[model samples]
Target: MSAGPFKVCMLGDFGVGKTSLVSRFVRSTFSDKYMTTVGVKVDSKEVARPGRDPTKLVLWDIAGRNAIDSVSANYLRGASALLIVADGTREASLAAALNLLMQARGLLPNAFAVLAINKFDLLDRWEIAPPTLTQLRRAMTVFETSAAAGSGVEEAFAAIVAGLDP
Candidate 1:
């Protein structure tokens, strides 16, 4: 809305599918091969907001790691929002995602943020217990996404855009 470009950073644990989610949302593609992001891969997609105009989201796919240092501050310099992701099949990644969320909020206190639990296509192997999900939900706006199936990916991105003022 307001017809302006907004930067949104994707922060999460390594192999949590941050790149895949970005690919799916921006390019409508998903790759099975695991590729660790070196620094940040920027991508853009325009999303329409409910009862408002569209906005261009410059998605900053920050390098994922167990710690926030893996993400260069340069990449977060102008971010307007955050998408903190976790691997559903790996419970530990959830912790890392929360850590990244805290770091992002600390750096950009006024920015909107989302907690995404990725790899939903692998539902059979999901290791995140219900209690954890509840806890995560209380912590942030949580989404269960499957980049491989294109489920919830669009909504996740659109939600961030909608959070911006019109």
Candidate 2:
């Protein structure tokens, strides 16, 4: 990995648990209270890789937006990777996540990206079908995560780090 920290932008629809995932990974904590992100919340974590120096990741938790805008595009500037999150319980959020991915790719075609189907703890209520999830996994690196339960949270971050340029 490079000496400088990599900037990772979180892209997803509203209430997709992007903030919760960041909190869980960075602070080893989660909260039930819901707080809307105003602009962007920044956090950092250093992850270790075997046989290589530790790499620092600067996480940018952008406010949820169904569509891309000037403000959102500005937030994605200089991103090295994208952690596209979607709410598993709400299938529409998946569509939103895909849209966000397209926009992000348009801006940063070479940036590494990963999908995180969040809220796995609420899988019983998920509207996304099994076939769709299987298709998604075939298309990209996908992680079923539940920030509330801490399931797959660390693995998701680790996957992002592993996928980045070394």
Measured against the true structure, the TM-scores of the candidates, in listed sequence, are 0.93, 0.97
Model 2, clash count?
A: 0
lDDT of 1 by residue, 18-79 (tens): 99999999889999999888878999988876777767899999888766663366678888
- Write model 2 residue lDDT over 1-166, tens digit each, in one string: 4664999999999899999999999998999899999999999999987677888999999999988899999999999999999999999999999999998899999889999999999989999888998999888989999999999998988888888854
Highest-scoring model, TM-score: 2
Lowest summed lDDT window (length 10), candidate 1:
65-74
RMSD of model 2 against the true structure = 1.0
Error of 1 at 112 (Å): 0.5
Residue 44 lDDT in candidate 1 = 90
Worst 10 residues of 2 by lDDT: 1-10
